[model samples]
Target: MSGQQHILEFRFLAEPTDVNFGGKVHGGAVLKWIDQAAYACAVAWSGKYCVTAAMGGIQFVAPILIGDFVQVRCRLVHTGTSSMNLIVDVRARDLKAVRDRLATQCVLTFVALDAPDGKPTPVPKWIPESEEDMALARYAEKVMEVHRRIDQEVSDLRPAGQDH
Candidate 1:
Protein backbone atom coordinates (compact mmCIF):
# COMPACT_ATOMS: atom_id res chain seq x y z
CA MET A 1 0.00 0.00 0.00
CA SER A 2 1.04 3.56 -0.65
CA GLY A 3 2.02 5.75 2.24
CA GLN A 4 -0.82 8.17 1.72
CA GLN A 5 -3.24 5.30 1.76
CA HIS A 6 -2.75 4.77 5.46
CA ILE A 7 -5.98 6.42 6.51
CA LEU A 8 -9.12 5.14 8.16
CA GLU A 9 -12.21 6.86 9.47
CA PHE A 10 -14.86 5.36 11.69
CA ARG A 11 -18.13 6.93 12.72
CA PHE A 12 -20.39 5.70 15.49
CA LEU A 13 -22.96 7.01 17.85
CA ALA A 14 -22.04 7.20 21.50
CA GLU A 15 -24.69 5.11 23.13
CA PRO A 16 -25.84 5.35 26.71
CA THR A 17 -23.77 2.33 27.59
CA ASP A 18 -20.61 4.19 26.61
CA VAL A 19 -21.07 6.83 29.28
CA ASN A 20 -20.07 6.94 32.87
CA PHE A 21 -22.41 7.55 35.79
CA GLY A 22 -21.86 11.25 35.24
CA GLY A 23 -23.47 10.93 31.82
CA LYS A 24 -20.33 11.56 29.79
CA VAL A 25 -18.73 9.06 27.51
CA HIS A 26 -15.78 7.45 29.21
CA GLY A 27 -12.31 8.44 28.04
CA GLY A 28 -11.25 4.82 27.90
CA ALA A 29 -13.96 4.11 25.36
CA VAL A 30 -12.65 6.78 23.08
CA LEU A 31 -9.13 5.55 23.61
CA LYS A 32 -10.15 2.07 22.57
CA TRP A 33 -11.64 3.53 19.44
CA ILE A 34 -8.42 5.35 18.73
CA ASP A 35 -6.40 2.18 19.07
CA GLN A 36 -8.74 0.26 16.82
CA ALA A 37 -8.50 2.91 14.13
CA ALA A 38 -4.74 3.18 14.40
CA TYR A 39 -4.40 -0.56 14.14
CA ALA A 40 -6.44 -0.56 10.99
CA CYS A 41 -4.14 2.02 9.44
CA ALA A 42 -1.02 0.17 10.43
CA VAL A 43 -2.23 -3.13 9.06
CA ALA A 44 -3.26 -1.54 5.80
CA TRP A 45 0.05 0.20 5.36
CA SER A 46 2.25 -2.69 6.29
CA GLY A 47 0.18 -5.63 4.97
CA LYS A 48 1.42 -7.43 8.06
CA TYR A 49 0.47 -7.74 11.68
CA CYS A 50 1.26 -4.67 13.74
CA VAL A 51 1.59 -4.02 17.43
CA THR A 52 1.10 -0.85 19.39
CA ALA A 53 4.47 0.37 20.54
CA ALA A 54 3.29 3.57 22.14
CA MET A 55 0.30 5.85 22.51
CA GLY A 56 0.69 9.41 23.81
CA GLY A 57 -0.69 12.94 23.92
CA ILE A 58 -4.15 11.65 24.77
CA GLN A 59 -5.71 15.04 25.44
CA PHE A 60 -9.44 14.98 26.02
CA VAL A 61 -10.36 18.43 24.82
CA ALA A 62 -14.07 17.97 25.42
CA PRO A 63 -16.49 15.45 26.77
CA ILE A 64 -18.65 13.43 24.46
CA LEU A 65 -22.18 13.32 25.58
CA ILE A 66 -24.40 10.35 25.09
CA GLY A 67 -26.38 10.41 21.86
CA ASP A 68 -23.61 12.27 20.10
CA PHE A 69 -22.00 11.11 16.87
CA VAL A 70 -18.36 10.29 17.31
CA GLN A 71 -15.80 10.06 14.58
CA VAL A 72 -12.41 8.48 14.93
CA ARG A 73 -9.92 9.38 12.23
CA CYS A 74 -6.47 7.87 11.88
CA ARG A 75 -3.79 8.77 9.40
CA LEU A 76 -0.16 7.92 9.01
CA VAL A 77 2.00 10.99 9.52
CA HIS A 78 5.50 9.53 9.64
CA THR A 79 7.33 6.25 9.25
CA GLY A 80 10.65 4.62 9.99
CA THR A 81 12.25 1.42 8.76
CA SER A 82 9.91 -0.69 10.86
CA SER A 83 7.73 1.78 12.72
CA MET A 84 4.90 4.16 11.94
CA ASN A 85 3.58 7.29 13.59
CA LEU A 86 -0.17 7.81 13.25
CA ILE A 87 -2.25 10.77 14.28
CA VAL A 88 -5.59 9.84 15.75
CA ASP A 89 -8.35 12.31 16.36
CA VAL A 90 -11.70 11.70 17.99
CA ARG A 91 -14.40 14.21 17.35
CA ALA A 92 -17.92 14.47 18.67
CA ARG A 93 -20.90 16.12 17.03
CA ASP A 94 -24.26 16.86 18.49
CA LEU A 95 -27.17 15.17 16.83
CA LYS A 96 -28.63 18.59 16.07
CA ALA A 97 -25.52 20.73 15.80
CA VAL A 98 -23.64 21.55 12.61
CA ARG A 99 -20.12 21.43 13.96
CA ASP A 100 -18.13 18.57 15.34
CA ARG A 101 -15.92 19.39 18.30
CA LEU A 102 -12.61 17.79 18.96
CA ALA A 103 -13.13 15.46 21.89
CA THR A 104 -9.79 13.67 22.00
CA GLN A 105 -6.47 13.59 20.17
CA CYS A 106 -3.46 11.32 20.38
CA VAL A 107 -0.41 9.98 18.56
CA LEU A 108 0.37 6.31 18.25
CA THR A 109 3.48 4.41 17.22
CA PHE A 110 3.14 0.93 15.73
CA VAL A 111 5.74 -1.64 14.83
CA ALA A 112 5.04 -4.07 12.06
CA LEU A 113 5.80 -7.68 12.85
CA ASP A 114 6.03 -10.97 11.06
CA ALA A 115 3.04 -13.09 11.98
CA PRO A 116 4.88 -16.41 12.38
CA ASP A 117 7.85 -15.33 14.48
CA GLY A 118 6.64 -11.97 15.76
CA LYS A 119 9.77 -10.23 14.51
CA PRO A 120 9.98 -6.62 13.44
CA THR A 121 9.42 -6.21 9.71
CA PRO A 122 10.05 -3.39 7.28
CA VAL A 123 7.28 -1.04 6.19
CA PRO A 124 6.96 1.35 3.31
CA LYS A 125 8.56 4.72 3.97
CA TRP A 126 6.08 7.55 4.36
CA ILE A 127 7.33 10.93 3.15
CA PRO A 128 5.20 13.96 3.75
CA GLU A 129 4.29 15.51 0.42
CA SER A 130 1.97 18.39 1.23
CA GLU A 131 2.01 21.28 3.68
CA GLU A 132 -0.55 19.63 5.91
CA ASP A 133 1.32 16.34 5.73
CA MET A 134 4.56 18.09 6.59
CA ALA A 135 2.96 19.78 9.57
CA LEU A 136 1.61 16.47 10.82
CA ALA A 137 5.03 14.92 10.39
CA ARG A 138 6.62 17.75 12.36
CA TYR A 139 4.10 17.35 15.12
CA ALA A 140 4.75 13.62 15.20
CA GLU A 141 8.48 14.31 15.45
CA LYS A 142 8.17 17.06 18.07
CA VAL A 143 5.71 15.25 20.31
CA MET A 144 8.39 12.75 21.29
CA GLU A 145 10.02 15.29 23.58
CA VAL A 146 6.78 15.86 25.46
CA HIS A 147 6.27 12.12 25.78
CA ARG A 148 9.78 11.71 27.20
CA ARG A 149 9.14 14.43 29.73
CA ILE A 150 5.91 12.79 30.84
CA ASP A 151 7.64 9.45 31.16
CA GLN A 152 10.39 11.02 33.24
CA GLU A 153 7.90 12.77 35.48
CA VAL A 154 6.09 9.54 36.16
CA SER A 155 9.33 7.73 36.76
CA ASP A 156 10.37 10.42 39.20
CA LEU A 157 7.09 10.02 41.02
CA ARG A 158 7.93 6.40 41.73
CA PRO A 159 10.75 5.28 44.00
CA ALA A 160 13.53 2.99 42.73
CA GLY A 161 11.89 -0.42 43.40
CA GLN A 162 8.44 0.98 44.15
CA ASP A 163 7.64 1.53 40.51
CA HIS A 164 4.10 0.25 39.93
Candidate 2:
Protein backbone atom coordinates (compact mmCIF):
# COMPACT_ATOMS: atom_id res chain seq x y z
CA MET A 1 0.00 0.00 0.00
CA SER A 2 1.42 3.39 -0.98
CA GLY A 3 0.33 6.31 1.13
CA GLN A 4 1.45 8.79 3.72
CA GLN A 5 -0.75 7.25 6.42
CA HIS A 6 0.62 3.72 6.34
CA ILE A 7 3.49 4.25 8.76
CA LEU A 8 5.11 1.30 10.38
CA GLU A 9 8.08 -0.50 8.85
CA PHE A 10 10.58 -2.25 11.07
CA ARG A 11 13.64 -4.17 10.02
CA PHE A 12 15.78 -6.53 12.00
CA LEU A 13 18.31 -9.20 11.36
CA ALA A 14 17.62 -12.69 12.58
CA GLU A 15 20.44 -13.91 14.75
CA PRO A 16 21.23 -17.38 15.99
CA THR A 17 19.24 -16.67 19.16
CA ASP A 18 16.11 -16.09 17.09
CA VAL A 19 16.20 -19.47 15.38
CA ASN A 20 15.50 -23.06 16.43
CA PHE A 21 17.39 -26.29 15.95
CA GLY A 22 15.83 -26.74 12.53
CA GLY A 23 17.72 -23.64 11.33
CA LYS A 24 14.53 -21.62 10.98
CA VAL A 25 13.23 -18.76 13.02
CA HIS A 26 11.03 -19.86 15.91
CA GLY A 27 7.28 -19.37 15.59
CA GLY A 28 7.05 -17.45 18.84
CA ALA A 29 9.79 -15.15 17.68
CA VAL A 30 7.85 -14.31 14.55
CA LEU A 31 4.71 -13.76 16.63
CA LYS A 32 6.52 -11.31 18.85
CA TRP A 33 7.65 -9.40 15.78
CA ILE A 34 4.12 -9.27 14.46
CA ASP A 35 2.75 -7.97 17.76
CA GLN A 36 5.39 -5.28 18.02
CA ALA A 37 4.81 -4.12 14.47
CA ALA A 38 1.03 -4.05 14.88
CA TYR A 39 1.24 -2.20 18.16
CA ALA A 40 3.34 0.53 16.61
CA CYS A 41 0.91 0.94 13.75
CA ALA A 42 -2.09 1.15 16.08
CA VAL A 43 -0.43 3.67 18.33
CA ALA A 44 0.59 5.81 15.38
CA TRP A 45 -2.92 5.85 13.99
CA SER A 46 -4.72 6.38 17.33
CA GLY A 47 -2.11 8.55 19.02
CA LYS A 48 -2.78 6.66 22.24
CA TYR A 49 -1.52 3.67 24.13
CA CYS A 50 -3.03 0.49 22.79
CA VAL A 51 -3.21 -3.09 23.98
CA THR A 52 -3.78 -6.22 21.97
CA ALA A 53 -7.37 -7.43 22.16
CA ALA A 54 -7.17 -10.30 19.71
CA MET A 55 -5.11 -11.77 16.90
CA GLY A 56 -6.47 -13.67 13.89
CA GLY A 57 -5.31 -15.68 10.90
CA ILE A 58 -1.67 -15.90 11.82
CA GLN A 59 0.06 -18.22 9.36
CA PHE A 60 3.72 -18.87 8.77
CA VAL A 61 4.11 -19.34 5.06
CA ALA A 62 7.84 -19.80 4.84
CA PRO A 63 10.85 -20.36 7.05
CA ILE A 64 13.22 -17.53 7.96
CA LEU A 65 16.59 -18.93 8.71
CA ILE A 66 19.24 -17.41 10.93
CA GLY A 67 21.23 -14.53 9.44
CA ASP A 68 18.29 -13.47 7.34
CA PHE A 69 17.11 -9.90 7.58
CA VAL A 70 13.43 -9.63 8.28
CA GLN A 71 11.15 -6.71 7.58
CA VAL A 72 7.67 -6.18 8.96
CA ARG A 73 5.29 -3.88 7.13
CA CYS A 74 2.28 -2.88 9.19
CA ARG A 75 -0.76 -0.83 8.25
CA LEU A 76 -4.00 0.26 9.87
CA VAL A 77 -6.81 -1.65 8.21
CA HIS A 78 -9.82 -0.37 10.12
CA THR A 79 -10.94 1.46 13.23
CA GLY A 80 -13.89 1.20 15.54
CA THR A 81 -15.00 3.41 18.43
CA SER A 82 -12.16 2.21 20.58
CA SER A 83 -10.46 -0.51 18.61
CA MET A 84 -8.32 -0.77 15.51
CA ASN A 85 -7.34 -3.54 13.12
CA LEU A 86 -3.71 -3.71 12.07
CA ILE A 87 -2.43 -6.02 9.35
CA VAL A 88 1.21 -7.04 9.40
CA ASP A 89 3.16 -8.84 6.71
CA VAL A 90 6.48 -10.38 7.62
CA ARG A 91 9.08 -10.94 4.90
CA ALA A 92 12.48 -12.47 5.08
CA ARG A 93 15.27 -11.25 2.80
CA ASP A 94 17.31 -14.13 1.51
CA LEU A 95 20.71 -12.72 0.72
CA LYS A 96 21.68 -16.01 -0.77
CA ALA A 97 18.79 -16.04 -3.19
CA VAL A 98 18.75 -12.24 -3.58
CA ARG A 99 15.04 -12.23 -2.95
CA ASP A 100 12.50 -11.74 -0.20
CA ARG A 101 9.73 -14.14 0.69
CA LEU A 102 6.66 -13.73 2.85
CA ALA A 103 7.31 -15.50 6.12
CA THR A 104 4.09 -14.84 8.03
CA GLN A 105 1.02 -12.66 8.09
CA CYS A 106 -1.47 -11.66 10.80
CA VAL A 107 -4.27 -9.32 11.67
CA LEU A 108 -4.09 -7.85 15.15
CA THR A 109 -6.91 -6.08 16.96
CA PHE A 110 -5.99 -3.44 19.48
CA VAL A 111 -8.00 -1.32 21.88
CA ALA A 112 -6.97 2.11 23.00
CA LEU A 113 -6.72 2.30 26.76
CA ASP A 114 -7.51 5.12 29.14
CA ALA A 115 -4.57 5.84 31.36
CA PRO A 116 -6.68 6.48 34.43
CA ASP A 117 -8.39 3.09 34.65
CA GLY A 118 -6.88 1.25 31.73
CA LYS A 119 -10.36 0.89 30.25
CA PRO A 120 -11.22 1.17 26.60
CA THR A 121 -11.03 4.66 25.12
CA PRO A 122 -12.42 6.21 21.99
CA VAL A 123 -10.45 6.40 18.76
CA PRO A 124 -10.85 8.32 15.56
CA LYS A 125 -12.71 6.93 12.60
CA TRP A 126 -10.60 5.58 9.77
CA ILE A 127 -11.41 7.29 6.49
CA PRO A 128 -10.08 5.42 3.51
CA GLU A 129 -8.93 7.93 0.92
CA SER A 130 -7.57 5.67 -1.76
CA GLU A 131 -8.49 2.44 -3.49
CA GLU A 132 -5.72 0.52 -1.79
CA ASP A 133 -6.79 1.77 1.60
CA MET A 134 -10.38 0.86 0.86
CA ALA A 135 -9.32 -2.61 -0.14
CA LEU A 136 -7.58 -3.10 3.19
CA ALA A 137 -10.69 -1.90 4.97
CA ARG A 138 -12.76 -4.41 3.05
CA TYR A 139 -10.42 -7.22 4.06
CA ALA A 140 -10.71 -6.14 7.67
CA GLU A 141 -14.47 -6.23 7.41
CA LYS A 142 -14.30 -9.87 6.32
CA VAL A 143 -12.09 -10.65 9.29
CA MET A 144 -14.63 -9.00 11.55
CA GLU A 145 -17.36 -11.11 10.04
CA VAL A 146 -15.46 -14.28 10.90
CA HIS A 147 -14.90 -13.06 14.42
CA ARG A 148 -18.61 -12.30 14.80
CA ARG A 149 -19.58 -15.78 13.68
CA ILE A 150 -17.15 -17.36 16.13
CA ASP A 151 -18.52 -15.27 18.95
CA GLN A 152 -22.06 -16.18 18.06
CA GLU A 153 -21.25 -19.89 17.98
CA VAL A 154 -19.58 -19.67 21.37
CA SER A 155 -22.58 -17.86 22.83
CA ASP A 156 -24.97 -20.41 21.41
CA LEU A 157 -23.08 -23.21 23.11
CA ARG A 158 -23.17 -21.65 26.57
CA PRO A 159 -25.45 -23.05 29.32
CA ALA A 160 -28.58 -21.14 30.22
CA GLY A 161 -28.12 -18.20 32.65
CA GLN A 162 -24.35 -18.66 32.14
CA ASP A 163 -24.34 -16.77 28.87
CA HIS A 164 -21.65 -14.19 29.29
Which candidate leads the pack in lDDT?
Answer: 1
Whole-model Cα lDDT of every candidate shown, in order: 0.90, 0.85
- lDDT tens string, model 2, 1-110? 21235459999899999988898999999999899888888877777789998887778999998888899999887888999988889999877778799999978899
Candidate 2 pairs with clashing backbones: none
Show where candidate 2 strays beyond 4 Å.
1-5, 154-164
| lDDT at residue 25 of model 2 (Cα atoms) | 91
Task: Report the C-alpha lDDT of model 1 over 14-129, residue by residue, as the tens digit.
Answer: 99989999999988888889999999999899888999988887899999999999999999999999999999999999989999999999999999998889999999998777
Which residue pairs show backbone clashes in model 1?
Answer: none
RMSD of 1: 2.1
Poorly placed runs, candidate 1 (over 4 Å) = 1-4, 152-164
RMSD of each: 2.1, 3.3
Cα miss at 81, model 2 (Å)? 0.7
lDDT of 1 at 139: 95
For TM-score, the strongest prediction is 1
Q: Model 1 — TM-score against the truth?
A: 0.90
